[model samples]
Target: MKTVPIQIALPEDEYADQLAFLKKWDDGPKPPGWELTPKAVVVFICGGSGLRLENNQRMDIAPKFIGDRSLVERCVVTLAGARGLLLVGEPGTAKSMLSELLSAAICGTSALTVQGSAGTTEDQLRYGWNYGMLLAEGPSEKALVPSPVLSAMRAGKVARIEEITRCQPEIQDSLVPVLSERRIAVPELGDYSVPAREGFCVIATANLRDRGVSEMSAALKRRFNFEHVDPIADKKAEVALVKSRTQRAIADAQALIDVDDAVVDTLVTIFKDLRSGITEEGWSVAKPTTVMSTAEAVAISTSISLAAAYFPDSGAQLALIPGHILGAVRKDDEKDTERIIAYFDKAIQRRANANPNSPWAILWDNRHGIS
Candidate 1:
């Protein structure tokens, strides 16, 4: 039997070629322990058009994050200066994805990461001990187990802390000394300490929705430069991104049907309207409690596309839009189901009335999916 490949690849592995290309593409001075110059790193995330090598080979860098280039630049600048960078944003706005891309481009790997949660202990962010080794040989260097942050300090690479606010306040505060002093003191080793290498820095992400869950102390907040990531504001750009990503997802799944662009456009419009509580036509709509982010839109599009591919005779792809929207909206709150139905009764129904033959009409007709 043929072996199955992994479903998802890390940023470092997925963008290995692009990272290598950027490294050779720019020979400019880079900060200590950085693989790419700050300029190249920005381009790697924001993308560049018409880039060429000495051989005149055209290599266009694809845009990974669909947000402000300025924000990405600020992040690079912070890391370049050896300061911690905190990216705070609404859920599903690709904050964690941006962190991974930056780490992969700066170093050669994005695996040095600590996922923050309520159960996260200080040892996960600092260091732990190997009980076996500790018991057998007493507290020694060999008995010490370094966390991802410690590993990054030793390797002079970027380390990521995802959902930093999800961790307990006290546990989160453990990073204060590490970020400020740039060293992890090991009392077990008798005054020994692991100083952060020249390139070592941190990139942490926190969701605005998680504010009350585990608020960071003022001292911890002061240690990092905060950047607020917002949702994509341009409709055309978001639609294009959703279509591109959905098509790519279908291709990755080896699906047989082509993605319906009209379906994707309609789906994204609904998401934007629900997300912003306002329609493109200047109509007011009740926003769902759940985040109707572009990432969610892409997932719904991919699901609808794959459904069409697998069940070709079920119905037209456009007909699947309302059901998927209902599914996406009903995730966080049960009342959101009523909100979605009202949206269908208002914005979608109006669109259907405006043009009875358009995709909106199909969505309006299938509005019963919400109920």
Candidate 2:
């Protein structure tokens, strides 16, 4: 019996077995380096709630995104069709997570990733020479160190470039031809080049908020089909996301912290108000410079739960919510505090009126006490 790869992040080991067992299956031909076809990639990631595995294991892979199912389907299709995919969104949107999931599901390895940063170099995008070996021996294939992108091409697998915009524009542009030509040319090595295998593709992510840092060149932009992953805005969706994420966080922490719905509601409300820069009633307020993302909300809520569990008497109530919200919002400007205060008074105060147990209200009452 063949064992499934252990590196796959899905809770299940053999997704193929899970797919077959879950009868809701119709898959196209698998690509050169992919375990499943484009269609199966969709079903695998989105999950099959009613499907069953061979050993009676249900396909319990929970849906990751709260957005349109069609968008996910489209992304999978785009990748399967060999088109380069670019997932652009604000900070904390699940672009990285989504890329990892897709890479794992399709190529059976999500480790082939290049993290974009200010110091990222062309060697990272293409291939780097083992400098010691290169100095000892002339420019030879033996001295060449293949980057994740090159390895992905040679292996016919998907390569992920995260925070593509964070890399300098020139460095980021190096991927344009690798995407369009689907090959990386190395004139120094020999009269040969690295030709991408049949299933090779690039999945890059960019942050809209980091637009000015290192913009993706127009040519590079033209090489990808962009998909913007937005934050989950609906209260119900946001609540579900936060609850699930918080639960996982607690589980990871090995702590028995139970976050009630009231707490979850308060956290979601604060995140939404601060993100949208307006009350639920459409009253406009000054917006903060910091990013109020769902990821941050999950993190903040998890912290609050741990605090409540460990120090129940520390007065971690609605009053504490503002401080947490303030820390998350006041990133680049002091003006954000005024906006946060306005939101607390207009939106949070009203919410507290409706729900007296709101943790944010405690923060509002003790606003002056917070630094």
- Top candidate, metric TM-score: 1
Per-residue lDDT tens digits for candidate 1, residues 1-371, read 99989888998898888888888889999999999999999998999989888888778887999888999999999999888999998988899889999999999888999999889999999999999989999999888999999999999999899999999999999899899999999987989999999889999999998754236799998998999999999889899899999988998999988879898789888888888899999999999899988899999999999998998898989988877887787887899988988888999899999999999989888877778
Give one digit per residue, the lDDT tens place, for model 2 in 242-326.
9998897777776776866777787787678667877667877667888889999888888877877777886754445656777
lDDT (C-alpha) at residue 133 in model 1: 88
Error (Å) of candidate 1 at residue 95 is 0.6
After superposition, the stretches of candidate 2 with alpha carbons farther than 4 Å from their true spots are 1-27, 53-58, 212-214, 353-363, 369-371
RMSD of each: 1.3, 4.1
What are the Cα lDDT values of the candidates?
0.90, 0.77
Clashing pairs in 2: 318-359, 318-360, 318-362, 318-363, 319-362, 319-363
Predicted model with the maximum lDDT = 1
Taking all chains together, the TM-score of candidate 2 against the true structure is: 0.88
Quote each prediction's TM-score. Answer: 0.97, 0.88
